[model samples]
Target: MNQQALVDVAAVSAPCQGALHWVGMEQIALPLRVAGQTIAGRAAAGVNLVDPLARGIHMSRLYLALAGLDNQELSLVRVASVLETFLESHRELSNAAFLDLSGEALLNRPALISPLSGWKTYPFTLRCRRDEHGLQAILELTVGYSSTCPCSAALARQLIQQAFDERFTDTPVTHDGVREWLGGEQGIVATPHSQRSQAHLSIRLANGLDDLPLAAFVDRIESALGTALQTAVKRIDEQAFALANGQNLMFCEDAARRLHQALRGQAGIEGFRLRVVHAESLHAHDAVARSEWNWAGS
Candidate 1:
């Protein structure tokens, strides 16, 4: 059997001063698990090889170490450990290390009425870094939700009322007559537009620890938002979705504010950044708002 040859690339050159140095690899694929589910993700791994004299780092070691990770043992905690390993393995060349993982997390959710459930995929990013001071980690989650236009609902109500007043001026005003008028063409009005929305939430941990339950955090956000979009739906599920849409009417700003409040109230969150984007159905442009929890000063 022909064995793969190992090369030593950590050769040092002349030392330099007052320069920020970084050395590592990117787009390294690894098997990972969050909440007991196996997933394949790509991580951009790096470390601050501050040794001004070092030629480069052991890039192959980083890939080999990550490739040995097992699904059963993969978690945020494991990720942080791997980062530590990367730093320690290159101790001669660097004193700091960073790892970034990007991939989709699939979650199965039950429908409102139907007994069947479906999977929803969310984009997720996990990052960890270590330095002389300590370690820091961040979890980024992306969620998709539906937004309804409150203004349109109000306008629709007003148009129906106006149509009723005009059509029933000469005849007796009755519930059936009003319903018919509201359902007719004159009562049908151009509704204000609301669109499907998405939010990117990032939470920073106080320590370098990454033991938080990512899947559970995502579930909490999904539940707080009431309804999440799905890949597959039956008739019953569709009707239930319509009901949910009618009940939860929110503007772009309203959604952002709500998420801000929710994240602020969540336990174990030291710092957070929230960004909400609404793809408007009425206009060509999108509306976005961002909020960040300032922990450095406060």
Candidate 2:
């Protein structure tokens, strides 16, 4: 039996001829090494099809070129090399190449007041575009923490004062009794409302910088907020977290400003944008704020 040769249908001329702004594959499953960790990532690879008369691009070649990302750790320099390879593979057909790789970055975070440690997964994305002029790269990630409302804390303190006055109106106060009451829920009649909040950070890397600084970004944002969410905790750790929340109270606007200042100080960042989301426990809707810096003509 004679086997029919495989047909290269993508290479044939299109019945309706037109150039495409972007043509390639997306959601391609691939394992990527980034900042010393192997991540399961999805890559969206594409290039501008410049030849209007040409049938179509070689999609398989674009897919095959993504293999370059698997062998080396992900960095701007390495990503630029991969994009160069993509353009080379599609030589006459494309002048620009784009790659977007997204995945969860896992890290071991220790408890605030205990020796226990657990893993935290941060959703991260790396995007790069390469053209004749040069390569532009950006990194994005989300860090979740606890946000305590300053207004709510003050209101809570007022309520606790009222409760204390009502309870101790005639009764003589004793040190041991007061201590016991403080240890119990009766001592603090109300508590400030706190909610799970997240900071979405997107930073454009300097043209000459190659380091991603994923962990550094996370550390800075969490340190600014002062109430990073814990993965594993003991009773002491929970108490410590509560103390942190009490000490570092903030609103959505406060969180956004803090992140803006922190990101602006990073050396690797040329331009940046941030969005802070506080899932309000007191209200039905979420509180949100956004900030951007150094993004003008470029």
**lDDT of every predicted structure (CA atoms):** 0.75, 0.89
What does candidate 2's lDDT look like per residue over 1-298, in tens digits? 9999898776778888988999988899989876677889999999999998788787888888888888467778778888998899888899999999999988889999789999898999998999988999889899999999999999999998887887778888888877887778888988999999999988888889776778888888899889999999999999999999999999999999988998888778899888999999999999999999997754
lDDT for 226 in candidate 1 is: 67
In candidate 2, residue 56 scores what lDDT? 78
- Report lDDT (Cα) of residue 26, candidate 1: 85
lDDT of 1 by residue, 154-255 (tens): 887787667667777898978987788667776665554557899889888656344656777777776667657866679988888877877778877777
Q: Candidate 2: which pairs clash?
A: none
User: Against the hidden reference, what TM-scores do the models get?
Assistant: 0.86, 0.94
Total clashing residue pairs per candidate? 1, 0
